[model samples]
Target: MADDMTDNMLILSMISQVFALILRSSFLSGGLGDA
Candidate 1:
């Protein structure tokens, strides 16, 4: 049970990281395009 919980937490963390990265890049691209 503990192992399963840990795996789920890891997956969540990875997904969050990917989402953050996408947001960051999109913001940067948008700013550059505006200028």
Candidate 2:
């Protein structure tokens, strides 16, 4: 049970990180385009 919980947390963390990276890159591109 504990292992399953840990796995889930890890998966969530990875997903969030990926989303953050995508958002950051998109924002940068948008800023450059605006300039």
Q: What are the per-residue Cα lDDT tens digits for candidate 2 across 1-35?
A: 99999999999999999989887887888854654
Which candidate's TM-score is highest? 2
Where in model 2 is the C-alpha error above 4 Å? Answer: 31-35
lDDT of each: 0.87, 0.87
Which residue pairs in candidate 1 have backbone atoms (N, alpha carbon, C) closer than 3 angstroms, thus clashing?
A: none
Clashing pairs in 2: none
Residue 5 displacement (Å), model 2: 0.3
Model 1: CA > 4 A from native: 31-35
Q: Write the per-residue lDDT of candidate 1 for residues 1-35, one digit (tens) a residue.
A: 99999999999999999989887887888854654
Q: Estimated TM-score per prediction?
A: 0.82, 0.83
How big is the positional error of residue 29 in model 2, measured in Å on the Cα after superposition? 0.3
TM-score of model 1 vs. true structure = 0.82
